[model samples]
Target: MSASRPLEGKVALVAGASSGIGAGIAEALAAAGADVALVARREAELTKVDAAVSAHGVRTLAYVADLADENVPQRAVDAAEAALGPVDILVNNAALARTGPIHDTAPRHWAQAFRLNLDVPFLLSRAVLPGMRERGYGWVVNISSEGSLLQAEWSAPYSITKRALNALTAQIDLENRHLGVRAVGICPGWVRTDLAQSPASLGVPEDELLSPADIADVVLWVVTRPSTVSVGPIIPVRPVSKSAQTVANWELYLREMRSYDTSGGHLIDLYGETR
Candidate 1:
């Protein structure tokens, strides 16, 4: 659209792009002149984003694929390539967060969280990396959470998987640094998205939360930076807390108490004393 667009002629694939942060990022990329492929589970939601991206004067394709399904990532990538050409940019923004005491969490829930949060990104990266490496240019941005660096109570699976994802981001960067492919982890603190307001999440009001568009702006800046200057990691915090460790631990303690029994009285007391 605009002559100053940094991403002119580039192609991007944004996973979890039906809404929230993913949609915001997709729209921004399109505005910067990148043809985009929007991926999500719901075709209706993807259509909405596709319409908006197309209005920005960039080619847009809507592909519905459930990231939870192990085989879906490759299929989605293939379809995106067919529609928009080789992916020059990829945003692994799809994720799931489950908050509950480790002992109280069911095995199935843990598996689902791992698959969605950790496995999906890993698989999608693998699917798109080869083509990127061959082209001698590509950008992979992994959307992570601040919870990864904190020991959040009741949110064992969320915190664990995010931490692992961050580690995976670094590993990818190290391995592909010389291949013209770059990876970075974008960790945002509390964004006001539907997922953040869900019954299972900490319901921070929209007014008090970081807007998805805000995070998307940062993503655009990072990916559009000079290829010679690689941005390895970036953290964007809203209402910036001094430290997240204490808050995470306190939340964990309260969660542990909810599942405590008579035998856990001593453990509860210890947690109280520590807090």
Candidate 2:
């Protein structure tokens, strides 16, 4: 591998690549010379991102599909493999931002959140694991959230599913470590995406928000590290500004976590606010 283009021959499949962090990650991988497959529901946005990645002189494939279909994960992987080869890096960045008080949320909403936020990654990982194992090298990066640790009020679905994602990351690592695949979960705090800038995040400090590039840099570093370095963990990349609030809320967040219903979910709107 060239030092300037460590991922020169790598194939990376990034879900939720229509925009924001997903787009950023794809760009970073392409800059490192990785052929990229961008997957998301927006054909237009995917095409735009595909163009940007191709500018880096690497191969690019766009698979437009809503992962909520359950069957979409395998199909997405199949398409990527056919065009770009078996995935060397898989970034499970697709997520549903379901927000609502756990006690009053509906069961179907919960099901939807779990299906997208948790199940899709599990399905995608399953579809790609065999090839990665045979090749004896792969990275599965789960883009969890800082909310997973906070479990804040009125955000039950989002928080719990992400926490479960972190657990899934550990479970995947435990099972696949010996097979030469690594699973790393990243919990980013207040990324400066459109969602973070929405009215819902009113009191949030803009300057403290980490850029998608910040998260992408960390992911790139994680995947390129020597295999012997051991980097498969649920890492929390919180903004320093929010750390104190998280610490203060931890006790309350946990104490009341189990006292309410866990089946209701209110989905995030276009701007990422629960409506």
Candidate 3:
């Protein structure tokens, strides 16, 4: 292990790592001296993240696979382990959010959301547990959303699947706690990411939105704790300031977007902010 980085020699596989929260987490893990496997559907974007991960002098493997695919979870895990050894940490950050009322949401969209948000996490977690049990060590972090806890209207598919993901996190922790494997779910409130800037999420105050790196920092902190400490099963992440929920309409969202200027200020102040 590298004396300077607590995660030295560790291997982290981050799903949805092409951008947003997954990308942030991947960078953080690499900086902490962990080799990383970046997974997502976009090969070009994953390649970019791979470059950033490589800059930290740790190994990096970019795997372009949609998490919704039934075979992808185990395939990605197998490939990462083959190249970088067994994964010491698994970050289930991939998710799909299809906006609509429960009644209006199509069956296919609902299934897609569930597959990506809930089933993918389950599959990846299942794949890594055996290796983790044998090694007697591993960390699994599931990236849930505020919808998991809060009643976010017009997003029943997302909310329902994330709620299921929360249950999975708890069950995994309960079953594996005694075996040196810990699983935790992070429910982040309005976050400043491209995905969160959708028409459904309008009117969310800019001040209250969390940066992706904020969640990344929390993930790192959770995994770096003493062996005796097991952080699980859910961590609710709200920003310091309060924000409005979903917008009233698309016009409102468009108006807010027009007024929002992200270029002037840093969304994440790494040194000054407290988690």
**Model 1 worst lDDT window (10 residues):** 262-271
lDDT of 3 by residue, 1-275 (tens): 65568999999999999999999999999999999999999998889889998999999899998878769899999999999999999999998876655677789998898889888999999999999989989999999976566443354677778889999999999988799999999988767788767523554556656889999999989988878997768998876654443222322442354443334322112134311
Among residues 3 or more apart in sequence or in different chains, the pairs in candidate 1 whose N, CA or C atoms overlap within 3 Å are 100-154, 153-252
Model 2 lDDT at residue 6: 97
lDDT of each candidate versus the true structure: 0.79, 0.83, 0.82
Q: What TM-score quantifies how close candidate 3 is to the native fold?
A: 0.86
Provide TM-scores for the models: 0.85, 0.86, 0.86
Q: Which number leads on lDDT? A: 2
- Ranked candidates, highest lDDT first: 2, 3, 1
Residues 21-101, candidate 2: write the lDDT tens digits. Answer: 999999999999999999999899899999999999999999999988958999999999999999999999999887767
How good is model 1 by TM-score? 0.85
Candidate 2 has its poorest 10 consecutive residues by lDDT at: 243-252
lDDT (C-alpha) at residue 172 in model 2:
85
User: After best superposition, candidate 3 residue 73: deviation in angstroms?
Assistant: 1.0
